[model samples]
Target: MKSLNLYIFLLLATLLGTSCENDGDRVVLSGFQEAELKATATNVVLSNENSGKLVFSLMWDAGQLQNTYSERYGISATALTTTLQFSTQNTFSEVKEVVETSSSKSYTGKALNSLALSLGLETGKAATIFIRLKSSIAANTQSLFSNVIELTVTPYEEIAFLYMPGDLSGGWDKYTTKVCSRAGNGEYEGFVEAAQWNNFKFTTEMSSTSGITYGSSPTDLYALDDSKDQWNIWFEEGGYFLIKANTNAMKWSKTAITGFYVTGEFNGWNPTVNAMTYDSAKKLWTVTCNITTTLYGIQILANGDWAMAYGDDNKNGELTLGGANIVINEPGTYTITMDLSNPEKYTYTIK
Candidate 1:
């Protein structure tokens, strides 16, 4: 019995020795090694999620023994839907799952810290959004942790136009002359100077039958073959005719305005044939005319120079030397002193 007891004691000693030997060589990491763990989650939804929720964790001892959790990414309890948990001895890390939704119609499961939200973007630059976070788990499990999450936002922009320069009131002018000839500057031309109003309203109607009549102005030296050959109509809708003075002369050309008849009758009687445009740069109002020689079927005893003989006021009387063959070459107002001594100056516009 003593030998059997000795053998059993030997067996027990051997077992204890073997166990100690195995344990001495084994390496176990509790809080001994550096506590560093990283956690990552896929499919993250930031909507309604706490911005500081755990997404990663790391732990490092500062002296005393304690468990702590920290992250390198922005964490939000709401940002993580799926979850993963890991630990570095004293540190805890987690990877979470999340779901993105298009609910609320206008609300998307994405960060909206950008300029696009502020200005209501149309079609320009793209806004930017980013999230960054830093967290430190407390040394004491019960102590409060230090965590931070940041968002950066930016807006987009582009170039655009507001308004253009032009007179809105002067829409367009369309005029037709007798014999189906066309007249007037319907479109703005670089060569022709624009007409200016002295005291007339731009919105007035110049189509009144009693206001003004159309006949050849003195500037138009050419005479029409027939009264029916000189009529001209102007289409200045929404605006009235305005005459501006040039720097050339002191007299403005005037049109012989007669009584108004219906449009058909007006068209039937070509009362005038001259249209003049002032060139501000050159200080001249150029006249355009078509003069035919078949008046009264007589090659009348008058100078071929259309202006001189017209001083015959009665149209039937013969020309007298007292009449001045007034030729205007500059920009200004002109008055025909046919009855010179009378000093009756007829006002005419050139510009």
Candidate 2:
């Protein structure tokens, strides 16, 4: 009877030990839980003088590092690494990473202007900057993004001229064939004559052997090849054209002009009286007439109508609607030339 009692007591003790072991295992596993991460920032500003020295601060939850690693990998957060990433795109397509190792809840860093420039953000323009925290444990990683911040950067201007080189244009000369003007928006615009089936492209410098050249593509502009297979854009018929391009956007467009005329003080302000001749090679309109040394108004009429007329506001070069009429101080067999290819700075010379 005593042997039976001892056997039963041993069985009960074994069961209790197993239950205790299970309870301890549960406690260990439940200690780790998913971590929550967040970040905050103040205003951000960028400028030319301060671009290289730009700095910003970010504050985050203190226990995120520990909780994230513990919950995800059953490891201590001290073994994980952290980085601050700056991106122009909220999707984080392109990112610049800066290592951060602050045990405190906040971090500060500089070199923001350099990062902004690398992302192609123009100076003197405001852009939305996206920032985030990248945490990693071994090869496993995760990102926590902060609220987007808007900043304006003062960009340095790089003087560049666009040249047209082709078989029919500029005689393929790189140095003397510069025809495009760079606008404030970084676009290039000018006039060029393309012969039927003639090929041409734009270049950054006056060199056929060196410098950046933009070539034609079916969908968008492409960088030309250095050695061979350089593509040239051609037109169906030979004519004078107005070309505009935004190289950064890889976009280009062209317009063909047929004729131009002038009518105002020279012809009693009649739009149909005097017609100017178009010099296709020079891409200008020219006319010669006798006039008095009177302060008479003159206007450039296109296709002989009031539908389109251009006048100068300051009488310097810029053209605007309802602009002041041109004044001819001296009257002779004056030769007048009008260049309308550049409408923003349309000019006329009287000699």
TM-scores for candidates 1 onward, in order:
0.13, 0.49
Instruction: Mark the 10 consecutive residues where model 1 has the least summed lDDT.
Output: 180-189
lDDT of 1 by residue, 206-317 (tens): 2322111222223442211112122321223322122221111111122221211111111232323232343434433344322222122111111222332232333332
Among these predictions, the greatest TM-score belongs to 2
- Assess candidate 1 and give its TM-score to the true structure: 0.13
Q: Scored by CA lDDT, what does every candidate get? A: 0.23, 0.55
Where does the lowest 10-residue lDDT sum fall in candidate 2? 25-34
| Cα RMSDs, all models | 35.4, 16.5
| Shift in Å, residue 9, candidate 2 | 71
lDDT of each residue in 66-158, candidate 2, tens digit only: 221233333343444555666777888976555555632332122344345445677666676676666543333233344444433344433
**Model 2 lDDT on a 0 to 1 scale:** 0.55
Off by over 4 Å in 1: 1-269, 272-274, 280-285, 296-351
